[model samples]
Target: MKTIQYIAAVLCSLVLSGCSDFSDSINTDPTRPGVASGTQLIANAALYLPGLSSSPKGEFMAQYLAETQYVGTSLYPQESTSFYSWYEEPLMNLQAAIDSDDLDAGEGPIANQIAVARILKAYFFWNVTDRWGDIPYTEALQGSDNFTPVYDSQESIYNSLFEELKAAVATVVEGDIDNDIIYGGDMSKWQKLGNTVRLLMALRLSEVAPARGKEEFNDALNDGVFSSNEDNLVFRHLPEANNQNYWYGQIVNQNREWWALTETLVDEMKPVNDPRLPVYGNPARESDEYVGLEFGEEENIGTEEYSLLGSDIYAQDAPVYLVTYAQVRFAMAEAAERGWIGGDAATYYNQAVEASVEQWTGSTEEVADFLTQPGIAFEPGNAMKMIGTQRWVHLYMFGYEAWAEWRRTGYPDNLVEPNGVPVPGRLSYPDNEVFNNADNYEEAVQRQFGGDDDIHGKVWWDQ
Candidate 1:
């Protein structure tokens, strides 16, 4: 684990010796790419999985729902740079690595890595399409085959991604495990995460393609899904130097601005006096020193006595959550509550809250108290809402995660749309898609708002 892994991870650029950039061609053994077959690529990339295990580092920007309330203000974030990086660089590059070899090989690690890479690629693209309408796909990663990949319709991309995950997961061959981290090469967990991804993506599809999304999701869940935490797809962080909390570094090092708890999140959590609030918020120096930046702020305001968009930030000690047991439980809670699956929402609902606190703070009693709060407690709604709400709360550091959830569920309904940056409501197409795949981008644009650049324009699936 001492070596960094780039297998579909940002650390890909981190290089074996920590080179600041990894955008150059990857040659595991610079003297061996010519002789490297599929096995070599797979083994090398698969070996990268151990490095993919990013510690509890940054603020859970994925879970933070960045675009919703964290942005347009001083969240002290790296914009969508990190999000897009995960999508375009690590995720896309890993997929390209596979084209280096055939996907139909006998039992081997590269093939397995390719199959898993495809699944992970689906996950990455799903996030990209959901957040930003049109994105480069077909020709995007060809590198040279097609210098530019066209932006596919958000709907088309979703359908294609869903299919990719389903196909890759189905291609699992027995005795094919060389470099796996989530399961230590155990293919069983691979099956679980793939199924879980299907279920998760399917549900999200409903917002854009109701009948299709629901139909697809129901089919996957009915077959089998992540039954427990062990089956979860998460990156556990080691509390070590250069591998500490992502958001922690800023807070501890006084990285100037940080995306703190908003009045909405703070107030919502405070109703039952959610103890997690303390775990989530940073008290400003004085009452007038408060500045809460919600989503949609036009500009960043310095600490001039504080504002509501982001008056305060969370502690540096906060964890950078990827996916978690609580999230899966919340997903189940929503499925059960809504009859998407057969179970009780209350059970999964409480389970979600409990799991979240336990995962966040590693305390069962703390989670129980937080769940008892009226907001987190279950009532009657889409199991989606219940689970989604917990997801948002639990997503303090994982901004992008909650942002994706909010796009799908609209829970924790206290969304504010401030002016400036136009709220981008939807994500902008990637530069590659815009430049190389001009035709696809044009098609997607027509389907959206007749070529309007407004983020408010809904994609076909979204509509």
Candidate 2:
């Protein structure tokens, strides 16, 4: 009986081992690869880009909108903010697609995919570096091989971004791209966006590196930037609740009355009869006219008295602009004013203001009247201020870009801070960096701003 039992156990063990081997053999099919395609990777990366521009903190910092309830972010406080998502998600996925075996073997033409990824990666890095002065660029996103990446100077990062943009625009090849939400795999649009982004980056260096800025700006303009409203780089949000516009999610679904139009913004627009004011905000609850609350007065102000975000902004399917023709035209106007380009500054300025009005109102009638206003007209000596202020108004919902521009140009200069606190210049490094990447964080602070992570410390470009 014992011998028989032993034989049965041995047989059962052998059968289980055979099944395990069979399962392992059938787990992978050679015809169906498990790796994500370049197209899919790019689509995923594109989804993350719009969120950077959606943060309400940016609007608060730029003084476009004031907080009604929690005003912590509006009044500058030393808080750590992490930008690891830029590296961990889209950038990592893009790198994987670039390194895929199918791409290298020419299963599909990889040039276009590579170009798009490079351009987007450059954009993400540019956003990150602009917010926080220096960041991990050269040695970043290398998993397991390099855990602690050194921070690269903002200057070096910008230089590398310029090269990446140039190569990306120049390397477009004939290929079919899938899952592209921005331009539906249109290489021409992607090329234009790349050049447009290059133009923006070049303009950032106007004060710090004027010669290089002029050279790159001209190169990008020649390569072709955004030409019209059709060429704007925008992300169209879905109607679904999970994928609705950020403002929709905040104002409608969340049932929160946190944001109100700022007095600074309303005062500027009301005097000039800016047509975009109605499009930008609804009338105040107490009165039929548009009214805004002062920044950092949440404790004193009631939510129902001030105007909330416009109904158009709460629509689920609203499009978020990554880059707009209005912005491009304004950049051109500034470039011409600074003698970086040959066109007349006034022409570009008028075109920019008109484009901005038409972009919201879908007509040119209101623009002509607005331009005739005293301060609205383009003055050669005050070209920079005029362009900067109009750009601020044009970039209404695009908070991050607006804040960056405000810091750089100092237009709309009289931003009233609560409690006599000055506006923040840069966000501090995330707390995780202090605990995890301590040495690198300390070194970055020491080298960049003499060992203090103060919000008032200006970035290299801002100087």
Candidate 3:
């Protein structure tokens, strides 16, 4: 807690020095050309996603870009700065500006900004909780009161996020949608997304907190959640060449470096004749033949020989999907399995699979033909497995979700730990978290079962 206070003090000191990171990223600078507000800050916070899949963030996501672990591993690291926004001190501090001493009830109020910030905060904290487990949430984003805040249980954190999401959604009543950056600021979409987020969170906890998770899932379902693609929660990527794809910034630019599709992901798609495969992986190094390089194969051997997932999707640039129609469908399928709601598990699962095929190439028959096969057809426990597997495949470039889904469902059973993984799970908190916030860092580390953010430790929720 003291660390959070000191950090706050330092940030406050920085504010007086003429430049403050806290207010700067959020457009809090008064001298800027155009007047900025909380809406822009929410937008900037979401911007963190693109940078994640493409640059240093991409390397972290790829966890394979490096020559050392070329193929696969525990997925996320346990010791690097998985945090894309700790550096955004200004945005984190913006909350304080609103709750300050000098405030007018109606002069450029905090409603829109606070709503967006809460939603954005949910997204940001989800990344942390999704990756690390039981992060310092009640304490986090507080700037001072919560700095170095103790970690909460994963279950508690999930609950809190849902509450925050609900309140954020409520702030934007049905009629107000213009300011929404995600859906033309659509309040309905925001509300739908809020409920949809609730559904996803419940699904994540289904196996862990079946009862409470089920109740929450029902509430979200009954409340009306996203049902169509038009309601999908995503940030459209600009044709901006620099931000096209994380890989475009990292691999496509120079020597053409990309991770060969792991055999685990490859094999799962092969049996079902999944269409997305060709779109996801590169061809075998030897020829344009469609063959996947096994996950743990000797570094990069037979891979250069085969063509991976259809080249069409990879060639154009796959947009970063924070959440999608396919994911919601799969979650619904999982909910059915638990008998939490109406709908056949196999039915929703099949829809999810076909959704993947269609999502990749825009063809429903293609999906039908693929699902007609035995390996891909709807079966008892297999539905979730198939849904999870394809979801993982679709998540090839989208880092955190792929890793998080794996933790929950353990599906697509083919994913293999790479040859020389340094650590399992995500990287540790940033160096600054350790050096300056030593006590908090130490306590958080102790809460982590592995003594450090090692793969063996089960995040409280996962445990």
Candidate 4:
């Protein structure tokens, strides 16, 4: 009894003595930072912005590339997709940056840091809502405070994104930011990018919300956006293995023959003698001629028989474009076609084509020749179709944006799936949401998609 009592007394004393030490050390991870600076957080958030833009699935879905092997994603399957990483990692870091007050000490000016975070947050959230409609927005990223955030309607989300972007543009102040991988802390470039994002978002609502789209589109243009390729928002990849381009990682480092140019894109480029063809793809090994595999073809096609992605794209340091002046020009052309902006639609169209070609080839001779072709030249009646098709072509490496535009415009309307299944309108909600956030997920589906988490269910703006 005495020995037991003695042991208990020693244990209690140790617990009492170690409690403060334990508390202090429990959250202290030597290798990990307890609190990253605002700049570091901004850098972290910027890193994730290019993920979907860099992914092959977006290209495959847009019919820019056909799968040579492992064709599961090419054929639409009812699969769960998640943007959880965006919310959990970089978005969290961005939130921390916005909420941090240490900017005056070393982390850039408080207003600038917060403004940058808001722009990035809007960018990430825009991607999320586009991929999966009715996402958790206004109440999202609240951490444990609101585990089951109510999903905000896509319309409401768009409204808030516009407001956030406007505020972010207005809030830019003089400050030096660290670890700014995108713009190197250039506030002007960041402002342009924010406004450009707004422009793209505004154009997305053209069909469904024409009046609102026109207002926002003009507002973004007046606010200032990308004017030239020099103003492109690109994430320049490093030569190191960890930070190399996605195509280089997949095609060179992994030694995978997983992707090939699609006939849909090559067919459009070939007859027109498009200069971008050579830049977009390599000649096939067998024929030494540019040939693309038809997307969703059931026949076993060898990678060598079809053209591979261009060597420039497979380079270790190829940059991923988030927004380009070509895209902005195309948007303007479309806006002009719809009478939302003042300008000749053909002029903007020609400029967009020239910009896209020059961006790839760094010369105008081929573009001039290509533009003079009968079918290639801009026509007033067919302006919308011309704009949509050319926009798809210009958005070659930017697969997600291309796919989104295709969904919106339906220009290349002849896309066919081998299985006879229709193209997916949106990606299904993540499996984690279905399993963990069951109630909220159900509510979102019920309210937005007629009680089904279906890929074919169109988003609000798609109408």
**What's the CA error at residue 408 for candidate 3, in Å?**
2.0
Backbone clashes under 3 angstroms, per model: 54, 0, 41, 0
lDDT per residue (tens digit) for residues 76-95 in model 1: 32233223455344454555
If scored against the real structure, what TM-score would every candidate get?
Answer: 0.75, 0.91, 0.81, 0.92
Candidates' C-alpha lDDT: 0.54, 0.81, 0.58, 0.82
Residue ranges of candidate 4 with Cα displaced over 4 Å: 1-34, 104-107
Say which prediction, candidate 2 or candidate 4, comes out ahead on TM-score.
Answer: 4
lDDT of 4 by residue, 161-256 (tens): 999999999998887565577777788898999999999999999888999999999999999999999888887776765566878988888898
**Poorly placed runs, candidate 2 (over 4 Å):** 1-33, 104-108
Model 1, CA-based lDDT: 0.54
In model 4, the Cα lDDT at residue 101 comes to: 58
User: Local error of candidate 3 at 428, Å?
Assistant: 2.3
Write the candidate numbers in order of decreasing lDDT: 4, 2, 3, 1
Candidate that scores best on TM-score: 4
Better of 1 and 2 by lDDT: 2
| Residues forming the 10-long window of minimal summed lDDT in candidate 2 | 13-22
Question: Model 2: per-residue lDDT, tens digit, 136-233?
Answer: 88998787678789888899999999998998889888764555667766789989999999999999988889999999999999999999998888
Rate residue 125 of model 4 by lDDT. Answer: 88
- What value does the lDDT take at residue 70 in candidate 3? 43
